[model samples]
Target chain A: MTVGIVGYGAFVPRRRIKLEEIAKVWGADAPAYKRGLQLFEKSVPGADEDTVTMSVEAARNALARSGGVDPADIGALYIGSESHPYAVKPSGTIVAEAIGAVPALHVADLEFACKAGTESLFIAQALVKAGEVKYAVGIGADTSQGAPGDALEYSAAAGAAAFIFGADEDLILAEIVDTYSWTTDTPDFWRREYMHYPRHGSRFTGEPAYFRHSMNSARGMMDKAGLEPGDFAYAIFHQPNGKFPMRVGKKLGFTNEQLETGWLSPWLGNTYSGASPIGLTAVLDIASPGDLILLTSFGSGAGSDSFVIRVTGRISEVQDLAPKTREQLDENKIYLEYGAYAKLRGKIRMAE
Target chain B: MFSPARAWREYPQRYRLEAAKCTECSKILYPPRLVCPACGGRTFTPEILPREGKVVTFTVIRVPPAGFTEQTPLPLALVELANGVRLMVQIGDVENPETLEIGMPVRLEFRRISWDGEAGVIFYGHKAVRAGS
Candidate 1:
């Protein structure tokens, strides 16, 4: 039973943030956000959508498009969320029930910061390869909230994606042929339980957390898989910003084209959990079975995961919102003031 | 607009306006490049940029990113330092952006560009101030 993506779905919230709103408040030109940061607009989550809700939405669509899920046939359900609604309860249980994955399915949450979603995919592939039950769902979802005036707020956005791995003939959209990983005891980024948001050393996140871990993992995976850098048609990684990916590509010799395929996050801010896997779904929508897709992920606590996937040519299309591409995300505007940003992000709470 | 990554790459250069002056030629590299463009020299010598310079050009930004939103209506100037190094930076303490001149004197400043979410991890980057008359 080869494990791969049988179905895939993506969900970016309906609301969009205008580039000028941020500029007007900062008393600066919009060009900075647009040209400097390379961010046009990012998706804003609605009141009805949280991590679990978005995850369910994407997973449900993925299941529906996959020709209906047996619910009981799934052996495991893993939720990869950095912005989980609850700190303790497993988001997996909530998502499994809402998506009807039912009991007997292995339920767990993966939280390696931004790498959780990509890591969850590997786990699902392993379980399926071992002939566990049959189908497994991996979901990466985030409604990332950044502090006001901080670098994270403007770019941080909301989105989610789900990928299913099963043993059947409709089988994986791409098989995880090889994998590699790297770890360093560095704190490039971390969010304490007491803190509502994550803290990252700006330069540190780029050089050490992102560049080092991702490069090491990708090279390790490439070397292990016996594939050259140019061999992979497309590659995707956990996107924290528009610049980091570009810088990393310069090091790995990935051309502007290969990097463009995974650039949704920077223009949209780091979607925390959804940053990477959602990108892969977008890639699958356009990729063919023979296309080689290399992937890498870097987490805050300093961890990286890399995988090589070969498209199956029969990539199933999953449902999505009104926007065909994230490029149109700019048109769905609901530009907010700082006060509004605070409220939407739940920074100020009313008495219950 | 300046993220930490951009800040670090320009750290010392940002402080004293230190930049690489290609040893092969007197050509001034404002941001200090490892590889010299003028003479195709691989190694450049690091030197402090001249403090007094004229604004070669400038633009006013009504919109800014996370760290710059508060400084909206900000003027950014491309100044040619005393040493003839041209650098683009935020020009603060200017009362009127329209009154801005192409050869305005700009001084260096250490400022907070933005922070990460949740009120911590301040990202420091360099900005410019109009030199006192």
Candidate 2:
């Protein structure tokens, strides 16, 4: 059974806060941060936008391109996010109900920091391959939080990407060639139960966590598939920043041309769980038939999920069915200043 | 704050935009009324209202009730859908309330309507964003 993406879609909030805008508030050097992280602006969720809401919209877009797959027939759905709106409640139930996938659906909310979205994708495709469900939806979304005046604030952003998996050859746009996951208990970044924002180990978040896991995952996946980095038409690594994906791709023998299509962290910021998944959506927007795409996503608790996808002829037909990821990233963007951004992100304290 | 029962009862309308169309008169009723007022029809079929529409009329609410203070000057509009169904909904992603005009085209998007608090139920519904945006 060939389980792959039957439909795919992505959603990014219209509002953006530029790095300079955030830097001006804290009196930090904008040029330095920009040059260092290779990030300029990040998507800001509206007052009404959250992990669950974004997931719903992304899922709706996925269903739109699903070739009329009845929402009721979706047997399972999973949403992966670090910033699920509720601590105890499941975001999947709300998403399932909204998309008309209820009663006969198996749904769960997954969290593993940034790679959570890929986690959803991994599980969703596996179930389809196992003949457990005819179709399954995997979504990665987040309105991530960063502490005030922290470096993470500049890149912690909002966005979502959703993929519907099925074994139906007629519907599969990108057939899954192989999948691999590399995980270890590395506490590079974390937030306590009651903490409002996450904490990182500065440079430690690099070498040992992101780069190590991502590199290992990509290498292991290529080795297992007996395919080199040069064999892939496009390669997407977890883009915590614009610099990391490019650097890691080069380290793994992938050219900039192969990595550029999915390198979205520069302008879109790091959407945690949505980071690489959204990048994959961007690549799928313009991918050619038989294009081989390698997607590797990394999370801070330390894990990476890599997928080898072979695009089908159906890619072109469905590419125009929904909004493209690049268009959403570049066009009709509503930029916000520091004050408005603060208010919308709930950084400002309200009167009781 | 909306009770769980009240919110759950309206899920059909809020979440899916489910409406009832009169079998006899072909009139659409949002909130899916049991009886069609136009023809006094007792039977109706389930229908989904179109997501795209034009603003028939709108108002900017400066002093909103609780649960809406964050979105001060909230722009609410009565939009007439392409299928001729009219409904009132909040205008989302509007940076300036002054930009809202009569007949401005819009598309409804799922959004968080309201919530009880940090730990309470978060209500989800559709809000109108400028079409093509």
Candidate 3:
């Protein structure tokens, strides 16, 4: 039973808002945001884009990279997002139906803040490993919200990543070596039941929230897999900002070259649940056979899900079957000003 | 709030573009019905519409509908697919709506149609994007 990723895909909205555009509005210096946060711009979802729509697109791409897997064969579908468009309905149902993975499927929407995406992946992988399903799709996506003028405004962004897992050895592009999770009761960030925006506990989101959970989960997974930081060809962490992932990687003895390819926060900003999943997609786009990749995701409620994956020869056969992650992130970008950004995001009130 | 039944009923056309093709006359019916309008044929084969198409005509909506005010000057177009199936869809990813012309090649992209309200059901459907963009 060699259950692992068969195909994967990513979706990044073309619209971008420079840190300077956001900084100028709140009277904060643009240079400070760029230098301190290590962020230049963030992707913005268009008026037509949301967690659900982005998830559908990413899932379609994943199916394309799947080397002709029938959508009808997907036994389970899950989507994780902090910014699901509908507060009540299931995003998984819409995504599954749109991608033609309906009728016979188990579907649900999961939320654990940023780690929500990988959490779905964790579940889907387990289901395949347990032989409960032949194939499962997991997606992490968000049109994440930040208060009008908070530090989060600089990083909260939109994107999605989808991964399909199966046990067929012939189609496996990577093999799941092992997985581990570290969780605890930490209130580093919260949003009221009906609040439009989330509030963070400032410095608390750092050491006690993201760092504590992420580091432990990564180390735990490594120890369980009997591997070390130096053994992996690529290591990616949940990027709340450009700084945290690099810092955590360094503290864990991972090198800059190991994290560089997946370091997209500087350009794409923190896509919440899509953060680590999208980073893993970037790494997969370039990784070769025999490559070992470690992925760790952190959520504000404070938990991390870490996985050790070993790339297989099938990677090269399907790597170019769909659009590459870098191609989506780099091409056809449309820069937006603060006013358009505000309007696009529905931060402006207009008569109904 | 829109009824889930309303959304559910349209799932076939909205999700997979499932249509009815007349087995005898070869006429394709979008939103497949019990009887074909062209040839009065009752028997039909299930067909999925081609995703690539060309804009037939278009309009720029400066004053939008209730939920569309955020994207004012929205470009909506009637697109004709390769198989001669035509449908009205919102044109996206264009920097300027006024520059749009008939016969502009387009590819179908699934996106959110509109929000019912602040906390309402989000309608998802197909929109048109400039091919290769």
Selected candidate, larger lDDT, 1 vs 2: 2
Across A1-352, the per-residue lDDT of candidate 2 in tens digits comes to 7878989999999999999999988999999999999999999999999998889888888888888899988999999999999889899999998888997999999999999999999999999999999999999999998998999999999999999999889999999999999999999999999889999999999999999999999999999999998899999989888799999999999998999999999999999999999999999999999999999999998999999999998998898898899999999799899899999999999876
True contacts kept of each: 0.00, 0.82, 0.74
lDDT of 3 by residue, A1-352 (tens): 7889999999998899999999999999888878888999999999989998889889988988887889999999999998877778788988988888888999989999899999999999999999998899999999998999899999999999999999988999999989999999999998888888998899999999999999999999998999989999999999989999999999999999999999999999999999999999999999999999999999988899999999999999888887788888888798998999998887998765
Best by lDDT: 2
> What does candidate 1's lDDT look like per residue over B34-100, in tens digits?
7788898877776756455778888998876554444556788887777656778877534347768
After superposition, the stretches of candidate 2 with alpha carbons farther than 4 Å from their true spots are: none
| DockQ of each model vs. true complex | 0.01, 0.82, 0.68
lDDT score for residue A155 of model 3: 98
Instruction: Give the lowest summed-lDDT range of ten residues in model 1 chain A.
Output: A316-325
True contacts kept of 3: 0.74
For model 3, the stretches where C-alpha displacement exceeds 4 angstroms are B1-4, B82-84, B98-103
Candidate 2 chain A lowest-lDDT run of ten: A57-66
Query: Alpha-carbon error at B107 in model 3, in Å?
Result: 1.9
Best by DockQ: 2
C-alpha lDDT score of every prediction, in listed order: 0.71, 0.93, 0.90
